[model samples]
Structures are given as C-alpha cells and as structure tokens.
Target: MKLLPMFALLIAGFIPLTSAYVDELSNERVFFNKMLEVLPGNWQGKYADGTYENPTSDWQPIEVNYQITSGDTAIIENYVDGNESAIMTTVYHLDNNDIRATHFCGAQNHPRMAGRVFDRSSNTLSLNFVDVSNLQTPADYHSRGIDLKIIDHDNVHVTFSGLENGEDSTRVFALTRSQK
Candidate 1:
C-alpha cells in the first residue's frame, strides 16, 4: 500500500518536467512552423537593381516556387530564371532544434546554412553558411547565406548572398504570390 503511494508521487513529479520539455520544443519550432505555413506556393518578382547577371540597369524577372516534401519534413524551394529553367534548389529542414538549409547551386556546389537568428517581431530569419559539398576550391562560386523576410501571407522579401571568386555577391527580391 505504501509502495503504491510512493509510485504515484514519483509519476506526478515527472509530469511537469515532461510538459515543460514539450513546451520548450514547441517554442523553439515556432519560426520554422511559421515558414512552412506561408511559403508553400509560387512567387514572382524581379531581381533588384544592379544585381542582374547581365549587368542590366533594368530589373530582370525571376520566379520561385516552394513545396513541402519528404512527408512534411522538408520544404524545397526552386529558383527559376528568365529562360524558365531551374537555376537552383534549396531544401529547408529542422535539425537539432535549428532550421537548416542546403542550397543546390547552379555553380555546381552545395552550401549548407543554419538559421540561428529569428526575429519574431519582424518575421525575419537569417541563415548563414556552415559547410559545403563539392566545392572545388575555396574561391569557387557558391551561395554564402540567405535572409528571408515574410511580409505577409501574400508577400515576401528575400536576399540571397553569395561568394564568387571569393567576392561577395547579392540579389534581393520582392515577391508577391502568383495566382497562377
């Protein structure tokens, strides 16, 4: 009879700890969940001035698409160029309670980044390069990082930063949801 009462007390002692752990995990994933909520669609926009590959003063058209994949374990983003060809693909997933992205670049290398900073008030997430694969050289062109800003469900702003020949390159996009 005494053992029954002791076991009940022991079980009750662990309830709060388990609940707190679950709550902590949920809080840690809020930003990732928000991204999954608003980014699964087609977006059309233009490259910001002075960033076009051809060095045009005019804004060049760009398209991006996002879809949930791997049984909702990942989000895949595809970048479409003016020629309507896929230029790059990025896969975003959560690992070790952090948001991580693997960018498959047209430059023929893969750069992995992690989103360690998230601003809830601004709805912004910044991911910086951690490691890479297939990089032939240290100076090879590859994506350096990405900054994602969610303006709303229908609009977003993204800045893709890269390194080319060991020089910094950046492109900014202001995208609106495409009805088509």
Candidate 2:
C-alpha cells in the first residue's frame, strides 16, 4: 500500500536522529566512567588564590576526599579549607546523557554546573555555571565555574572560579593522591 511506503520512509528518517542521540549518550557514559576511575580517593594539596605560585607560607592546606556512592551513581567531593575551617561539598552525576554537578559553597548557595567541555585526550573536564539555588540576591556570591585536570593517576590540578565582592575570584589547588 502507498501508506506502507510512507510509514517506512518516516521511520527511516528518524533512525539517523536516534542513532546520533545514542552515540552522544555512549560518549557521555565513557567520559563519566573514566572520571570515576580517576577521581575516587583522598587528595592532599595546598590552596592559593589566583595563581598558586605564592610563597609556601601563604598557601593554605587543602584536603579533598572523593567517594563514589549511591550505588556508584554519584561522585561526592568533600573539600576542606584549612584556613577557614570550612567544609564544602560537590556532587557529580550524569543527568540524561549529560554530566552535571551541584556545588555547595560556604556562601550559603548552591550553584549547578554542567560539563561544557570534555577533553578526553588530556583528561580535563570543565564545567560552567548553569544556575543557582537558594540565592537570596542577584549579587550574592556563588561558584561560577570549575576546571578539573588529572595530571596523572596520583596528581591533579583543580581550580574553582567565582564572583566575590563584585570581583572575579579563583582558588587553585594542586593535589596529590594520598597513599595512606
């Protein structure tokens, strides 16, 4: 029948679109799995503002513990700030074929970010601000971005960017995976 051919054509046209979507999902799964492989551990480092090239005396101790929980569906990062005795947390998980994160900051706001760029060859994942929750004011401080790089199995460099006091601020931490 004529309708049979028409329906076949319609289905055929949608096949490519579905395949492309599936390919994207597969890539995201691969990226997230790679992240799980490299990110679960206790990391110790020093933190500094802007550039971490300041004198050792000026740098503060930074300790981070990453755990895979919720049936391995989420990665949680507990960030300890030695200078302020503050502990912040961020949770990373996949949301419908996209990697997303929610950072709980000391500013009393949570900023949600999504993975904007993933360079598999370099082992880098960059997340940019999407929105914020519990923001009392438009100018209230909240995290803006995150840049995470795995230098090696035991070394990592992370930078967090935000707006504070109406100025762009950054915290850089150079971390080494703790052996003990």
Candidate 3:
C-alpha cells in the first residue's frame, strides 16, 4: 500500500517534465517551418529618393525573384532601371540565435556580400545586408546595404542605404507580389 502512493507521486512529477520537453520540441519545429515559408517567392517594387542627381527623372521600378533552395540557401534575381539585371545568391543559417544570410553578387566579379535577418512574422519578413567585400571596383571601396520589409503576402517595403563618397544616402522601395 505504501509503494503504491510513492509510485503515484513519482509518476505525477515525471508527467510535467515530459510534457514540457515535448512542447519545446514542437515549438522549435514550428519556428523552423515558418522561417522557410516567408523566404521563397517573387517580389516587385519601385525605388524613390531625392538624394540622387536625377532623383525625379531616375525614379525606376525594381523586381526581385527569390528561390529558397533549402533551409540555408537561396537565390535572388533582381531587375532595375527597366532592363538591367543582377543576380545574387544567399546562404542563410542560424547563428547565435539569429538568422544570418551571406550574399554573393556578380558571381565572377563583385561577389561576396553578407547580411542578417533581424525580424520575421506571419505576414511580414525583413532582411538587412551590408556589403563586406567588393570585387567589382577595388578603388571605389563602397558598400551597399538594404532593408526589406514585407507588409503582406504580396506587398513589401524596402529601404536602400549605401555609402557613396564616404557618405550615406537612403532610398525607399515599395513593391507588390507578382503572379508566379
């Protein structure tokens, strides 16, 4: 009779711990899956700013198509200035509890860009990248940075900031989701 009571108490204590362990595992899977969903697709928008020499006249639309190859890999193809195209590849992974993306552009010439993801939600996602190395122009020593925020499944807001002549300037980009 005494053993029965002790066994009951032990089982009661073990139940809560097991439940918590299962819950933690489930949460991790949910977060990982959500991260994958917001990362792949096509995004389009326009860039605007008054800092350029021909700001008003140079207002141009931009479109980006992204394909997430895996949990840690993606490719982005961008179109700007009506007909100019640029291709960039990014490899993303979790580091120090934060998601980081290493981007490469001009695959043969100006490749090697690095960035991190700071925020993500159900309907919104944001990415920030700062140029670390530029093989395109060594004398220029310029860095390009971008912040992209998704407002919905089809609309996004982007901010482009970069160093020019050792000074920083910013431009805003508004985009809509294009049909795949």
Candidate 4:
C-alpha cells in the first residue's frame, strides 16, 4: 500500500538523525576526557559561603589531594578536615568518554553519577549530571549529583547535591593547588 511505503520512508529518514545525535554525544564525551587530563595534584581548600555577606578570610583551610594511578586511568581524590581524618574518597575515570565518579561517602551507600560537560573552556570544565546509580528512589539517602569545575591546573570547585528533607541541598567547596 502507499501508506506502508510512506511509513517506511519516514522511519528510514530518522536513522540518520539518530546517528547525528550519537555523533554529538561522542563529541561531548571527548570533552569530559579532556577535563580528566588536568586533575592530578594535591590541593587545598577554603570555605565558600554562598550568601557572600560574610568574610571568608578568617575561614578555615582544608586539604584535598588528588593523585592518579593505574597508569593514569583512575584518580583518587581525598578530602581531609583539620583534625587529620580523611572524610571522603572519590574515584573518577572515563568510560568511553562519559565521565563517572564513585563517591565513597561517610554514609552507607557509595553513589555513582554519570556526567556530561556543562561548560568547558581553557580554564574551566563544568560537569552537570546525566544520571545516577545506587539510589532506589527519590527519597533515598544518596548524592544525587555533582557540579565539578576544574579551574586551571591548580584550582577546582565542586558542589555535591543531596536530598535534605525532600529538597535538594548542596555542599560547595573551593580548592587550590597545594604546595608540595
């Protein structure tokens, strides 16, 4: 029938459109790999009061160290408070250009998030959330997303989003490269 031929043509036409979308995703994946290429070093951090109404000069300093291993295929990011107790360890890598992180939280679950490049430049790489794992539902206790921006070779900023009373609450950190 004529309708059958028209439907087949329509479906055939969509194949190339889908292929183009895949190619775009491929380009985005390359961007995430570029972000990982600049992330291996020890770093220090200070408070970021989002309100901007208070002075952060008197704020506390913290330690955040990064090191790559397994032939530069994995990065271990450790966060330490003033008391010298390492609080969290996040491992990051690229799976076919889709940046992924497994956050070993102090809590029970280690949530994983897939990231897409939110913004990228010569000095910054920002990753927005694409999807998440280790969460059963919306009410689960897990890190829902992360906003990671690598600023230059020595500075980075991060915001970890979690559910607080059924709403999204974020913990932000500003980090600088540590003097060895």
Candidate 5:
C-alpha cells in the first residue's frame, strides 16, 4: 500500500513532459496545413537589415527554398544569402494546429520554437521559444522568436528575433515567390 502512492506520484511527474503538446488541436492542424500550400517553391528575397548583412543597399539578395518530404508532415526551408555566403535550414512539422521548428544554427545551439496563427482570422504565424535541449540557459545564444506574414500568394515577410550580445534584436526578410 505504501509503494502504490509513490508509484502514482512518479507517474504524475512524467505526465507534463510527455504531454507538453496536448493543446495541439486537429482543427488548428487543418488550418496550418492549408496555409502550407504556398510554401513549396523557391523564392527571391532580401533581408530587412540588408545594409548590415551586405555592404550594398537594403535589398541585398537572398534565396529561400522550401522542400516538402515524408508526406504532409515534414517541411524543410533552406536559406542562402549573398551568393551562398551564408546558409541555414529550418525543419518544421505540424502538431495539430501548432507548428514546431528546429532551426539549424551556424553557432553552438539548435533552438526549437513553436508557432501558431496569430488569430483564427489572420494569416500571420508567430513562433516563440518553448524549450531548448542543448542550450544552457542564459549561457548559450539562440533565437527567441519568429513572425511570418503572408502578404499574398507570391509575397511573404519573415522576421527573426534573437538574443544577440545579451540584447534582443530582430532581422526581417521580404520574399517573392519564384516562377520556377
């Protein structure tokens, strides 16, 4: 009888971790998947702070390519900046209506963030930090959030927010879909 109570307590402790995404809803997944229809193509874009990323104008060239594989669940985004000088990838999947992504950073840690439509009537997707596995609290640098605004069938705006040099900052990108 004494052992039974301890066993129940241990099980309860593991529940939250195992069910962290319990709030993910099927209706939300349906909408998120619907929105993904616009993603699987190449895009030409420019960063918001193009002058800083490139010595040129504020519209420095960047390339974005989206590839979908493994059925409807997995989506991959590839970013190439300034004639392939910098490259990074983000992998996403749907959990109900909530979308989760693991950003493959060039630095030390791979930060994972979660996203959902800002509002049921809005097309903006806002992703915020949930938890990171390899990051050591305030010691390691990582991205804090991202906002994706779908302007139209061919235009999108992406914003990435990060903790850089112990301060918060953001970078924006304006992307246009490629015909090919």
Candidate 6:
C-alpha cells in the first residue's frame, strides 16, 4: 500500500516535468523554423552611410538581392550604380542557442564578415556582425562591423561602425524595401 502512494507521487512529478520538456522542445523547433523561413527569400534594399565628404551627396545606394538555397546557403549579389557586381555567400545555422552566419566574398575591400542574429520576432529580426575585415581603408587602420534591424519585413535600418584606436565611429543606413 505504501508503494502505491510512492508510485503515484513519482508519476505526478514526472508528468509535469515531461510536459514542460515537450513544450520547450516544441517552442525551440517553432522558433528555428521561423528563423529559417525569414532568411530564405528575396531581399531588395539600399545601403547608405554619411561617412563621405558630403553627408547629403546624391550617390546611388546599393541594390541588394539575395538567393537562399534549401541547404541554408545564401548568395548575395549587390549592385551599385556605375559599378560592377559584388557577390557574397552566406551560410546560416543555429549554434549554441544563437543563430550565426558566416559571410564570404572575394572583394579586396571587404573580405569576410561574421554575424549573429540577436533578436527575432514575428515581424522583426535583428543581426549583429562581430567579425569584420576592412581592407580598403588603410589610412584609418580601422575594423568595421555591421548591425541590421528589420522592421515590418519591408523597412530595414543598418548601421556600420569602425573600431579603431579604441574608438568607434558609426554610420546609419536606412532603406525601404523595393517592390517588384
């Protein structure tokens, strides 16, 4: 009779724990799938910064187009007015509870950038780039990083920062989604 009470107690405790575990697993899967879905699609936008001699100069911003493969590989092709195309490949995956992406392009100016997705919701996604190589600006001897925040799936705000001499200089880029 005593064994029956002990078994009941064990089963009751186990049920709640098991239920909580299952719920967590389900939530994780849902979040993962949502993250994957948001990345694999066409993204058309512009990039701009006020670092130039004239902040209001009418230089045409870049046109970004991305093709994401089923294998989580992304091909990013960018076009700037009167300039050749710039191509990059980005691989994205989940690493230790964080979504990470490695971006590689053979540009002499910018070699590679590594980033992580910090926050994600149904309508917004934010990414922060940690590893950046800036090979173009030698005089500045600066390292650059990027941060992107998506709003309403159509508007995106991007920031680029240069880390040099223990100081940081930031430039903001605001873009609207181009409708095809």
Collision count of model 5: 3
**Tens digit of lDDT per residue, candidate 1, span 10-115?**
9999999998766555544787787789899899987773333343356667899999987777999989977868898999998867778999988999999988
Clashes of each: 0, 0, 1, 0, 3, 0
TM-score to native of every candidate shown = 0.76, 0.77, 0.53, 0.69, 0.71, 0.50
Off by over 4 Å in 3: 1-35, 50-58, 71-93, 105-131, 135-141
| lDDT tens digits by residue: candidate 3, 1-180 | 999999999999999999876654454334434545654667676667743333543567677665656445333435434453554444544443344455453333232333333343532233454446544554443325545454555666655555545667666666777775
TM-score of 1: 0.76
Q: Give me the overall lDDT of model 3.
A: 0.52
Candidate 1 local distance difference test against the native: 0.82
Write candidate 2's Cα lDDT for 49-135 as tens digits: 885564333678788889999877799988876563438898989886788899998888999998777666767778899999998
* Residue 145 lDDT in candidate 5: 77
Per-candidate Cα lDDT values, in order, are 0.82, 0.82, 0.52, 0.67, 0.72, 0.49
Candidate 2 off by > 4 Å? 1-27, 52-57, 81-86
- Which residue pairs show backbone clashes in model 6? none
Error of 2 at 121 (Å): 4.7
> lDDT tens digits, residues 50-150, model 4?
31234434555778877787766677888888776778888877776566788887555677777654453533333445445555566766676767766
Name the runs in model 6 displaced over 4 angstroms: 1-46, 50-59, 73-84, 87-93, 103-143, 164-167
For every candidate in turn, the CA RMSD to the true structure comes to: 7.2, 4.9, 9.0, 4.8, 7.9, 7.7
| Over 4 Å off, model 5 | 1-27, 50-57, 82-86, 120-122, 133-140
Clashing pairs in 3: 45-175
